[model samples]
Target: MRILICHNRYRQRGGENLIVDSEKAMLSERGVEVIEYVRDNNEIDGYGLVKKAMLYFTTTWSKEAEREIRELCRKYKPDVAHFHNTLPLISPSAYYACKEERVTIVQTLHNYRFLCPGALLLREGGICEECIEGDFRPALRHRCYRASYIQTRAVVRMLKKHRQMGTYEKMIDLYIALTEFVRTKFIEGGIPPEKIVVKPNFLRNPPDPKYGGDYAVYVGRLSPEKGVDVLLNAWKKIKRFQLKVVGDGPQRAQLESMRVENVEFVGAVPQEDVYSFILGARFVLFPSVWYETFGTVMIEAFACGKPVVASNLGSMAEIVKDKETGFLFTAGDPDDLAARVKLLIDDPTLAIELGRNARAEFDAKYTAEKSYERLMGIYASVIREKETV
Candidate 1:
């Protein structure tokens, strides 16, 4: 199959970027022909004030992206055009380009951007779904995006425009939601249920499971949404379990300043190193306050025979069966988080059982072989449906 994958790269490498790269590689390794039309956010870094001001319009629809994509579609004549991130660079115009060429368009709903201006369903360090179901006023009122009214307004306008244009409804052939929780949210947010498919992220290449460790580990960005502060507070209450944080973000300075005891902040780490950290831990923690779509790291832990202690919210709650594969704590509750960790710490046998279960779960649901099957199945369905059209 000849596939055209387009993505607007983030300034800093984020999970979506990593997933896109992994997916492309996976397809290539399977002997599929993949063509890329990508743009980078770094292109805006050197732009002057006036040029930057023009970005407001492009975020909604980019004529340049449309032209470029149209040219590529004509040249490549790809069977399917799959898109990942298109935020400020590639824009929604890529959809129009694909539509013009009769190329099937499949988009992964990476976040809540289609339903919320903030893209995270997060505002002021908490969950906020004010813009879901086609109402963006609350987002504008709260200036929920990047804490800037202008930026929020810009995103809100893009959302409102494409929403009205039937871009979500008519242009795209399929929408790939990372989890069932995410798929349900999109359905609730007015996306058609039949068009949305649930496909969780998988480990492209995984390391062997390593068990038996005294320290607990956290693998994710140290940001407010990640609930790093909650983890720290929980750690303060119970210094019995040594904590190692593996990732960095804007909140690093604030978290480092807290002087939380028995914790080592390893800063940002590479993918392989993250697996090693998880392998060496007693259990992994994901204390996210917001409804995480699906955490890639959680699966990584499962693949490494490590039990995860995740927030009892969204995909985490569903993915990590409480006391089965991993434990789930009350979201943002430090005391509850501490208690869950204590449960595992007090009973190493239970932790080992959960770790074994988690590894089994990874093999059954998240291995590269299973992922490729589901991915190809989704693509085949889209292609078959497209042929009928």
Candidate 2:
């Protein structure tokens, strides 16, 4: 089968970008013909002020992107097209182009851009779902995007324009939500439940399961939304258990100033090195405050047979079975987080048992083989439905 995957690459690469590459590699290994049409956000940097000013309008509908997709579809004649992220660059206009070329559209809900303009249901250091009520004006009023009213206004305009044009409702054939938590949220935001499917991100090249190590590890962005400060505060109370943080972000300076004991800020290691840290950890810590779309590191930790102590919210709560595969604590609560850490450290037997369960879960649900099967079924179903219609 021929499948065309489209993505808008971010300026600062993250886990999502890595997932895109992994997915493409998996498809190619399965002998499927994969056609890519990727756009980069770096293009925005080269834009003049006048064009930047017009970005708000064009972000809603990009004729240039649409035309490019149309040309690619005509040439490749793929059975289906998949989209990852399409914000200001690719836009939802590409979906229209897919329809024009008789291509089945499959979009992955990587983040919460559809429900909230800031793309993370976060505002003023807390969860804010005002936009989920189907109104984005609050995002503008608070300047949620970049703390600038003008930028927030631009995002609001794009969101309003797309909802009016029925781009999400009419143009896209299927939506791949990364978790049940995310799927339910999308349904709440007015997406048809029938049009959405739950598929967690898979672990690529997972290591052999081996539990019990010297320290606990945290792997992700060190921003406020990630609850880094909460983590540092929690670590201050976590007695003997050493914490190693393996990421760098806007809050690095803030984190360094805290002087938390038994915490090592090993900023931004290579992906392979990050995996090594997971393999050598007693457990992984994911203290994100936002309703995470999915936990890429959680699955990786599971693959390495390491238990996770995650915030009891969103995908983290849903993914980590409390006291089964891992433990969960109250979101943004440092005291609760500290207690959970104590639970894992105090009982090495329990932690190892949890790690073993995590490995088993990864084998059952998150292997690349399983992901490939799920994707193939979704593609086939979409094609069959298209033929029937």
C-alpha root-mean-square deviation, candidate 1: 1.0
TM-score of each: 0.98, 0.98
| Each candidate's clash count | 0, 0
Q: What is the C-alpha RMSD of each candidate to the true structure, in Å?
A: 1.0, 1.1
For 1-389, candidate 2 gives per-residue lDDT tens digits of: 99999999998789789999999999999899999999898998899999888887778788889999999999999999999998878888899999999999999999999999998999877998999967998898898888889888877888888898888889899999999999999999999999999888997699898888879999999888999899889988985778999999999999999998888999998888988988889999999999999979999999999999999999999899999999999999999999999988988888899999999999999999999999999999989998999
Candidate with maximal lDDT: 2
Give the per-residue lDDT of model 1 (tens digit) for 86-132: 98988998999999999999999888889988788888877887778
- Stretches off by above 4 angstroms in model 2 are none
